[model samples]
Target chain A: MYGTNPFRELEALRREVDRLFEGVASPSKLRSAFLPGRSARSYPLINIQESGDDLTVEALAPGVDPASLEVAIEGGSLVIAGEKPRPAQNVSPEAWHRSERAAGRFLRKIKLSVPVDEENVTADYRNGVLTVKLQKADAAKPRRIAVNVA
Target chain B: MAENTVQKTNGSTAVVATETEATREPERFVTPPVDIYETAEGLTVVADLPGADPSAVDVNVEDSVLTLKAVVPEADESEAAYVEFRLASYFRQFTLGEKIDQERINAEYKNGVLTLLLPFAEKAKPRRITVKAA
Candidate 1:
């Protein structure tokens, strides 16, 4: 089953702290930056790395089902959309004090500066992290030249 | 029935009927125990908040939206880290359906649990009427 690790949990906490500080650091700039009608969603923290022949992007999305997620590369943008339904209510009458859990629809888009081979794109969801591997197109691959007149 | 207790870190606690084995297995961050019941007067929601203080909890309902926020007192920032199990502090929000009564919701915090009573509008709750023989 999909799950989250302590490191990922810590990263989530760090991201929240970063967001809080970002909003608090500059009251004026923040107001102008976060105008009404603007997107209130935060993009998932993705770890991108390049290997020999492919680029990988890993997104942390805990408690979200892989089947419910929609990942696509459209016109140089990677879009991930999904919704996490709220847990069923089971509260009793005599209970006191409650803590709210975060649950709702979420969408995240990432722009890829470099063109990748869409046909060979592969994705996997494991341990609450979605990893996408984009292979470079044939033309984009580096050519090996032979030593000639030297 | 006897009460079954699960000892969670950060002073968090969970209790259920001894017959319920769902609470037994190794604790994962699974769903916590809570229940919602509807009555003629309104909707009453009971939540388990172990080790939670009344002064530290906040509950509000507005325009069919219920928000619950609380702080689980942690050691001072300077205090040495002993061991951490679950995330500190708690936050939960629900955009209630139309059946919820926004103006007259009641809440109580005790025994480390939070109970919220959301009274629905007069016409919002279901009503059964007896029809005379035609």
Candidate 2:
């Protein structure tokens, strides 16, 4: 669902275009960002949203062990690390009908556009998604300023 | 015995399978990632669907077709200054295999992931027969 905010939609659209061109921009360098297949670093697909004074970072990853899930906010960079166990570990090699979902340990570090207060960060895991909220470190200054001639 | 072809919806690897029934729904849906494997007892399917209220998730089988649908609530992305992933309901379907026991199928949802157990019918289960030497 989209909101009435036109600026945000334009920003989202721009990001989408940039992401699509990434494959051609650097064929060998760009790995999958969200969905994992032959994924090396970009494991969980992430979406960052700025709502009011807080920045919410959402990672769409399911089946990750709650105990193994970890979120660390270091200044403007966020770290998400976790391990997803295989569903049927004991099953023989020949028993698999389909193994489309990815499994194993994953760690992703995202450089945020705005500075955030690490102390005010909160993380929650639900329905296989991880959402982290961080308060902006500095209040955005008002645009207009009066000039005085001495 | 012939086995049903398991067509996969792969948005990750980009080996997209042409789907007819999946796009029939007017509402937008995401094909949640899934892992399916078979053991001696039956088959186990694990799927990832974030933001789905456990009560709103639906799993059903009809006419030998297994469908998994979950109603997901939009997160903070509605008016976000920046966005990467958008929230959407989950929709995926699988045709039941000949060996599956339609009567005893089981389903469970936890932490936005759904696990389905499709046990093989008793007669279709693997069995060993003793040999007699005269």
Candidate 3:
């Protein structure tokens, strides 16, 4: 009972093979093999910027329907979820020469570093990118204290 | 991610000029993914270039080489707190084939995605041959 199990060793070998292929295999292929239904590792990449009193988050989401996009703030996390429809219509899958783009539902959650005014948040979609503006809370704004000379 | 190799600058003077231009370039750029499909009519190319202004995007085809360039507005770097995505411009190029009708090509950009329709030349399109009874 204390000896090594062959089944366990095979499982470990399979994981090792997966790790080895991860570096060389294309993302689309890896997704199909390992992550069947999960979202792409870092899809719809986002950039967060802060100004004097406002924070902006730009999300790159091309080929997504603006009407299907949903953005919400849950506690300290900003959640973005959307779906990208397939491009081909009336054509068989075998007709595609280069099927590089992936289409499916994706969800990404980002943590905000500063407290924001939930009521003042605004979101705009343009040129396939979604920019969300969140006004910093009063307490989160930087304050200046004057030194007194005695 | 697709590999969009950096353009090489030759000559000492050209290198010096590129050095100055590099300072104005964005820190980095992500290669936008593209999908190329063939249909009965011709070929269709779809590229994703998010955060790029439609007006600033340039698509040019010269000598069978198609180039796509887009400029993303630079944000205030001093205020970047949390950044998962890098802000940078996008550039990509592809070699076209002889079957493509370069003069009759059509393109459209919307919602950050660029679609190029390269119709096949009249001679390249498949035509049904009428079988005559001999």
Best model per TM-score? 2
TM-score of chain A of each: 0.61, 0.69, 0.69
Each model's fnat? 0.01, 0.73, 0.73
C-alpha lDDT values of all predictions: 0.54, 0.73, 0.71
**TM-score, one value per model:** 0.38, 0.75, 0.72
Task: Give the clash count for model 1.
Answer: 15
Predicted complexes: DockQ each: 0.05, 0.46, 0.31
Q: Give a tens-digit lDDT track for model 3, residues B40-126.
A: 787788887777888988899887777777888666667777655544576666766667788987989998888988888898777
Residue A94 lDDT (model 2) = 54
- Of candidates 3 and 2, the better by DockQ: 2
Interface Cα RMSD in Å, per prediction: 15.1, 4.3, 7.8
Candidate 2 residue-wise lDDT, B1-134, digit = tens: 12245543221111112244525577666677677776667778888777788988999888777888997765654657655566777887776766778889899988767999888789877679989998
Evaluate residue A141 in candidate 3 and report its C-alpha lDDT on the 0 to 100 scale: 86
Winning candidate number (DockQ): 2
Encode model 3's per-residue lDDT on A40-111: one tens digit a residue.
Answer: 456667778888788999887787888899999989888899988777776656555455677788898888
lDDT of 2 by residue, A1-150 (tens): 997999999999999999998746542231133257455546787777776677888887888899999899865689999998878768776556566677889898999887777788899998788989888776542245789999
Ranking by DockQ: 2, 3, 1
Better of 1 and 3 by TM-score: 3
Q: Where's the lowest-lDDT run of ten residues in candidate 1 chain B?
A: B79-88
